[model samples]
Target: MVLSYMEGFLLGLGAAVPLGPINILIMNESVKRYKNGVIIGLGAMSSDITYLFLIMFGLMIYVNQPEILNGLSLFGGVFLIYLAYTIYKNRDTKIDIPIQQVAKKSSMKLYLKGYILTSVNPYTVGFWFSVSGYIAGKELNPFITLFGMLSAILLWITLMPYLVHRSRHKISQRVSHWISLVSSIILFGFGIMMFINLFYN
Candidate 1:
């Protein structure tokens, strides 16, 4: 059991460290408003927990169906495209607004954006399904495994924003603009790739 818990923790940490749309968005937000980035992480973590529950309870059998998975992928692709467009549109907007006011006004929006962005990806569901299967095969306690994973995810989200916030002074406006542009391009590419995969595979 102890070994299993440790494995779960390592697996969770590895999974959460990947470069994805959510991570990019969190980093971008953190460079501006640290609190908003943390909120976004919370939202993403919530979605991860939901996927964990679904996989543990064997609901992933339904989620793995090709038709349902394809539909989800389609939605995710479209949403990513929309997000890329939004980011590009706002790329030039100065982040001169007061942090307090921005947080108060956009907290829910940021949270929802994170949740929706993470949840819509069929790949996320598939990854959790595989991870859950591995845990089951190892005879690990589901609760322990989930707890370990959640802890890793929470730690990552919290630490990432804190680090970015601390380094905000070092990041120049031109650098920030480049980051936003690069992030938008990456998201758009991912969205296009999803569509291509859907059609070809």
Candidate 2:
């Protein structure tokens, strides 16, 4: 059981450590505003946990169907493109105001951004599906394995933002501009790739 948990932890850590959309958002937001960054991570993590639970318990089997996956992929592509534009448009944006100053409505918007983005990501959903299938044959306790994965994800989301937040200080508008620009490009590239795949697949 302990070995099973450790293996699951390693798997989760590997998956979460990659520089994907969620990590990218967390990094960019953390540099600008720590609270927002953490909130985004929390929201993303929440979505991840929900998916993990559902997938492991066989509630997400329908998601693997061809039509549904294509729909999700298309939506995810468009969503990423929109986010890229939004980020590029707001490249010079900064919300250095105190945490308390951030409006409740805006906070919820940020959280939703994180949640919806993760949710729509076909890659994330598919990856978890594969992982769950793999574990099913290995005789691992699904709950224990999921707990390990959850712990790994929780650790990443918390520590990652805090580190980025601590390191970035008095960041200039120029730096922010470049960061946003690069992030937008990466996101746009991913979105375009997804769109291209729609026709091929």
Candidate 3:
């Protein structure tokens, strides 16, 4: 049981550590407001937990169907392209908005942003599906495995915002612009690749 938990923890950590769209959003938010970044992370973590529950409980069996998978991939790809375009368009805009102005928006909005971003990501769905299937095949207790995975995800999300907050002083407008540009490019590339894969695979 301990080994099973450990394996799940490692898998969850590995998945969360990747510099995907969610991580990029968290970093961007962290530079702006540390609490907002943590809220985003919590939202992302919630999505992960939801996915794990669905996958582990056999509710995600339909995801294995090629047609359904392809549809999800298409939706995710389109969403990513839209997100990238929005980011690129705003890359040059100077954000002179006051912190007080930013504070007017509720934290729930930031949390929702994080939740929606992670929820729409087909890769995240696919990953959880695969991991759950693997765990099932190995005869591990699903509850224990999920607990481990959730623990790791929570830990990563908590630590990431704090670290980025600590380094917020080092980030400048130019640096932020570059980060946005690079992140948009990465997301665009992934979206394009996903579309391409639909034809090939």
Clashes of each: 0, 0, 0
**Which regions of candidate 3 are displaced past 4 Å?**
92-109
Which stretches of candidate 2 lie above 4 Å from their native place?
A: 94-105
lDDT of 3 at 8: 83
TM-score of each: 0.92, 0.90, 0.83
Error of 2 at 56 (Å): 3.6
The candidates, ranked best first by TM-score, are: 1, 2, 3
lDDT of 2 by residue, 88-149 (tens): 99888765656666444378888988898888888888778878877888988887888788
What are the lDDT scores of the predictions, listed in order? 0.83, 0.82, 0.78
- In angstroms, give how far residue 126 of model 3 lies from its true place: 2.8
